[model samples]
Target: MQIVFVGGSTGQGGSPRLYRDELSGDFIVQGYLVTDPSDLAQMKIPDGESVVRVPRSLFDYLPKDDADGVA
Candidate 1:
C-alpha cells in the first residue's frame, strides 16, 4: 500500500483527508484511515498536515465521513 498526501492549494500542507462519504464527488476509491487519532499522529506528520494514507488492503476497512454539511 502506498501513502499519498492530498494538498490544499498545491503547496506545503495537504488538504484534510476526505472519508469515503465525505466527498460529494468520487470516494468509492477512497482508502481512508480507520485508526486511532493518537496512533495516526504517530505517523510523524507535521501538525496541520493532511494526507491520504494507504494500507496493505482496503478489502475490509471502511471509514465514516468527517466532514460536516458546512458548505
Candidate 2:
C-alpha cells in the first residue's frame, strides 16, 4: 500500500497534489473538496465516491510512458 508522489499544483494558499499507488498502479489525487451544491447536483455521485477539484497543470507531470512498468 505504498504511495509515491506524482505531482502537485503551485497555487497559493492551497495545494492540489497527485499520487500513485505503487502496488495497484492507481492514481490518487488530493484537492479541494467539491462542495458546491449546483456542481454536485449535475453528477450522480455514489455513496462511496466523491470528487475533488485540481488544476489541469497537475497532469502535466504525469508519466508519458509506462517504461518503468509501474502502470
Candidate 3:
C-alpha cells in the first residue's frame, strides 16, 4: 500500500505534502522510490544526504493538495 510522507521547507513555516493512496488497491511506496546517486551532483546541490525530523504539531499543519501530478 502507498503512504504519504509530508515534510517542510528549510523554514518559513512551510511543509511538504506527500500523497498515499491506492487507486487500484495495489499502491506501493517502495516500488515508486527512485534512487539517483548523481541527483545532487547534477542539480549542483549538497552531495551529503541528511535526515530531517519534524514535530507532530508541524506535520498536522502540512498542506494537502490532491491535484494531478506533472509527468
Candidate number achieving the greatest lDDT relative to the actual structure: 2
Residues 24-71, candidate 2, lDDT per residue (tens digit)?
888888888999999999999999999898888888878877876354
What's the lDDT for candidate 2? 0.82
Residue pairs whose backbone atoms clash in candidate 2: none
TM-score of each: 0.23, 0.82, 0.24
Model 1, residue 59: C-alpha shift (Å): 12
lDDT of 1 by residue, 1-71 (tens): 33333222223443333333343433433334546788776777777765455544442233334364222
Q: lDDT scores for all predictions?
A: 0.42, 0.82, 0.38
Q: What is the lDDT ranking, best to worst?
A: 2, 1, 3
User: What's model 3's lDDT at 29?
Assistant: 22
In the range 1-71, model 3's lDDT, one tens digit per residue, is 45544333335434333333535322212212224656433544445643333345544433445344311
Question: For each predicted model, how many residue pairs clash, with residues at least 3 apart or on different chains?
Answer: 3, 0, 2
Error of 1 at 43 (Å): 2.4
lDDT (C-alpha) at residue 49 in model 3: 41
Query: Candidate 3 at 9: error in angstroms?
Result: 14
